[model samples]
Target: MASTVSIGNGYGQLLRTRGAWTYLLPGFAARQPFAMLTISIVLLVQHTTGSYGAAGAVAAVTGVSMALFAPWSGRLADRHGQRAVLIPGVLGHTASGLTLTALALAHAPLWALFAAAVPTGASVPHIGPMVRARWGVTLKGSPLLTTAAAFESVTDELTFVVGPLLATALCTTVNPAAGLVTEASLTLLGGLLFAARKSTQPPVAAAGHARVEHASALRVPGVRVLIVAFLGIGSVFGGMQVSLAAFTESLGEPGLNGVLYGTFAAGNMLSGLVCGALAWRTAPQQRLVVGYGALALTASGLWAAHSVLVLAGLGLLVGMCIAPALITGYTLVESLVPAGARTEAFTWLTGAVALGQAAAVTAAGQLEDHLWGGSGFLVPMGGTLLALATLLALRSRLAVRPRSRTVARGVGHRVPVAVD
Candidate 1:
């Protein structure tokens, strides 16, 4: 009877955690644009410019810009609060998307497309980090925080799954610009809805506060290690995306790319949901190591896949480790950073992933152009292996425990205790 009760409680944690679903749903909506933007840009640019190299360059530039700005954006949110930072950011990002779409439809110059892409990327609202920060504030000191992290990871996987499929369908059916337009609309609408929820927003830190005296989250001992590891993981995602697209085109079925990528995310979503529900005694670092190992093992199989079916099957296995790893990483970040720095900390992590992805995408694009077929898979394989190595090397530093104190001194308020 005790075991049954514990199992039921574990699965019911998400529902039991008040306001989790409320914030999480809009967060999921806001994040759809992130998943859709890359593919949409690629399709739009490729169609207009008639060169995969140019398309890849534009996508890489956009990713790099977003990565470069994410931590700064997060810092602003930390100081000024979510609505203050996100509302303007979302508006600028949406406007940039509209500009890009117009440029693409008008058959503008390559330089014009690249020019418009900068603001689109720079204005990305770092919604993922903000959402996770809210979770930290809401569920502090509870075991259920882990479950919330898992749910967020599943939300990410689901968004990536749906976003890509939706973008592909729009691009294929309506027009190349349709996906970008849709992405802009979603970003504007969802960002406003998410920001309007005043009850759930985490409080801003006071200006010139001494709590902000501590150096950035980058200086936190374990954070740099996790950021580096996440960079590697991001490379795996970026490389896989480019490689899979190229692989499908080579197979004479370019449309299958979205379905194959969605299948990958589907595997991630399934594992994340299951991992979140079960109670685990293992330390997050141990789980992280195991996750990286799984990713490396599965990703290495890509080199051997000669058939589309085999590649799709391998994609599912490779993706299974993604959510578990990401969930563990974010949970660790929550435990490590001070309350005042949580949003910035999470954004830095997001930026690391973007940096890794940008680098890998550029490299994979080049490899696809020059190397033999399927050789591009090596980029992600190498990245996962590097991530595994980093985790193993820094295992000791990441051993910090979750703080149990309830007062959120950094945010100048108390996080309400979760009531069953």
Candidate 2:
């Protein structure tokens, strides 16, 4: 009871931090587009081109672009500042998103769509990672750092729950282009707003290090393992987005896609809240393995779900398994990498998920196109099992090194991390 009360108080204290709400609201809005992008692309492209394969391919292009470039953006932010990186990013993303929406609506060539998608994906502001970095800066030496991580994880899960449903509703009820239009508008407005709150932003990590050699976050062994594990989680997300859409469309109830997917995301949000509220006795490493094992077990049942009801139930179970792994993975980052490379480390993990989601979307789309929706479900099961095996084999790499430095304080302490 005391632990629970302290956890609750931790949240209360965090919210009470001066100027915290200023950036948090805008950050929340800016990051919603991340959740909306793939679904919006899948819906819009599939609507125009009439092929899930084409839709997936176009979306994959954007995902691949983002995955390739996000770390570079993070590195730049670490060297320069968040404002410098964000100004161009939000502007470019808005312009590119609008262009892609126009080309798709105009029935432009596949190459044209693919070309526009590059900048659209690459310029995503990564506001989640930025926000978490801000928390690290603000709560550097406080025990509230872990609480902040949990809060941010819950926020991210909430976005997943809301963003997709909003996009789906706009696409189905208003027009196919509405979702994309809103996404761009929100990106432009919210990104700028978040960027404007410069007070909360972390200072450039490289400011004092004149010509100092900075190491890449990729050099960390644990980061590589988490990236691979997150790839499996991404597969589930990508597979569910495409497969759920295809399944519902075949039933002649396309709107149900949002409802079912929302249910799945709701489970994720619920688990995040529960995970955050608990006073954990087990190590995050142990939690990670257990979480992933449950995820794989739940995913194995997806291929067997033929009805909407069955799929929703299995998806909820699958969703429930994700937060523990994700929360644990991000928490692991603090123990794994140095403070100077923290943003880049966060982005690398984010990029891995994007890359994995892109691959899974393409593969699942192909499977659904040539085979059946049931076959589409196979991708998640296969991807998770394969990645889970690698995680088991490489689990030793995730252990904390004896030489430690706290990311924010320069003192040695384990602070939990989270994403947008």
Candidate 3:
């Protein structure tokens, strides 16, 4: 067992790895667009069309397209390579995003906006999952794998904090379309830089590992459970995006939207850092359950928050609960799925989150338009409670499988299995 004192040393070891910064920095830049997209679409469409429902509908289309296609892209990355998949994806996303921005600003009909959104979203490179796959190969059997998951979760939260703040500021102060425009520019530049780092990319599954490569990652029982749980997390995110904006607008303090959301994301980042630094005696499955329960409880109070102060406090608490759950869930992925299928498995979870967020955005936007912002808050609490019940009922399905990785033998492949 590692002592608490090992926290700094643990992360330090990962930082000290040769060429780590090459991929890490560009990967960080490439992922900002995901955090920026939904809010940017929501803000811009709402500004141009004067309807939250329409804005959410457009954003939902984008989210759904991304959700449907992410796993396919991941499978291709596994079969071919990350560079091949990311190059065209990055180019297509940049072009499509620019088109969507133009259409929105021109007040083209809703159908045109939705049409442009499809390609805009579907081309989003699953950079975060690809980065995690790289980390998996780089540190295969080390205890630092768990630390790496925590580190990635922290990086995700940091992007959320910065992305929203930047997008919101650009939309509010510069131009309504500024957020999406800047997002496309970053995708082009950062994605190309990341793709050029060929040395760090995970090798394509060799022909000898064909059996493992051909099998779908979804065949694992645990991956399905994690996907559903991640969907609930996505609901919280999507619900909060629309609700917080509506609430702040109602108060004539629209700028607070970024501040409040940033507070929430900051909480997530802080807790992720703490999770990485600790050495735990309990299993990740247990931690996932407990963390989710806390998330559900904190989320329940959001609808009753009538003041900004109260809402911010509750948001921070809810955010804090998320990292432990996310970190543990990703940690479990390492054990439940085989090496060749890890990228696809990660994309499945990512896609599930996107799908859930799309649904929540549509539902919450309708509630905000017809009822009130408070009504939108109900979505997160309800989604989490229902998912928590499902999780409890299906908890047994999340048991970690025996550890296995495909190793190349002379003419074939064999998996060296280890007991967890």
Candidate 4:
């Protein structure tokens, strides 16, 4: 628990954080479209190639490349601030995407295609990492932290919900490569917007290098555990990306793919809103465990839904857990990490999830194509269940056990974290 002053159960503390919301607007706008581009790239390539395995390979390459670069990018951002790092990254992403799009249209060779994937992965800015790092710095232990996190989560879910559907429509009904053009243009615009703002500047340490407390955050046990947890989270998302769309098409209802995806995203957005509105009332670890449990149950229940309507409703229920777990994990990072390493900490968390999503998509892409598309969803569901089980088992290991930590803080008494 934050052990901080409690306002009456509303997130009034968040609402009162005057300058907070506006600073985030540009970021939300930029990310909303970028997140959609990820799906657009994945589905467009998969559909165009008629090979899920090929699509997964490309996605995997993207994930691996991005994951490899993410930590270093964060470190650079921390050292040089957002302008120095993000602008170049945004340009890099735009150039790379445009090059690849042009090359694809020209019917380029496979070698160039694979080469282009490297930039595609490398140029993708570490937005989640940077945004969260900014939140950690500005909000400290306030409700603004929770709200910012929830806000990001909602944007994340909503972006995927709306972004993909729009991209899909453009690809199917308009131009097969229309989404690529949009992705590139938005990357430039968003990256430029992020760079334009003076107030939203990222922090840099005195050392002028983001190395001081950086490595230590990586070594934290809980951090590692949480990172591992997101592996399943990534798989869930990856599976959903391919399978949900494919399943709808398989059922001879290709149009419903958009509805299903939108519904799933809606579920996540709704939950993020609900979770954000609730006052912080539970321990981060406890909240995380419960969130994963609910997520697992939702994932499992999704498998048994008998119809699209039932599936959509159940998917919404499952999506509800997305933001809460992330919010809880982020809080834990802030609670446990040294201030100096916050950027790196945030980077690892976001990058790790990205990597997981990439890996899941790569790992399961073939299976979905060769076997049952619905079968792919099982991978994520299983991963979420396993993640839930691991979290439960690690409870004793990670839990603060009231007396031990509270005794350290010497807070004499414990306060109930109120909801409602």
Point to the candidate with the largest TM-score. 3
Candidate 4's displacement at residue 385, Å, is 2.3
Comparing 1 with 3 on lDDT, the higher-scoring candidate is 3
Worst 10 residues of 1 by lDDT: 411-420
lDDT of each: 0.80, 0.85, 0.88, 0.69
Give lDDT tens digits, candidate 4, residues 189-272: 876787776575655666533343334456555767787777677777777777776677678886687778788778788877
Checking candidate 3 for backbone clashes, the offending pairs are none
Which candidate leads in lDDT? 3
Could you tell me the lDDT of residue 120 within candidate 1? Answer: 92
Question: What are the RMSD figures for all models against the true structure?
Answer: 4.9, 4.5, 4.0, 6.2
User: How many residue pairs of model 2 clash at the backbone?
Assistant: 0
Q: Which ten residues in a row have the lowest lDDT in candidate 2?
A: 411-420
Which stretch of 10 consecutive residues in model 4 shows the poorest summed lDDT? 402-411
Score candidate 2 by lDDT. Answer: 0.85
In model 4, the Cα lDDT at residue 213 comes to 38
Candidate 3 per-residue C-alpha lDDT over 351-379 given as tens digits, one digit per residue, 9 for 90 to 100: 88788888888889999999966788998
Q: Which regions in candidate 4 have their CA more than 4 angstroms from the true location?
A: 1-22, 107-111, 208-211, 304-306, 396-420
Q: Name the regions of candidate 1 deviating beyond 4 angstroms.
A: 1-8, 208-214, 401-420
Tell me how far the alpha carbon of residue 405 in candidate 3 is from the true structure, in angstroms, after superposition: 9.8
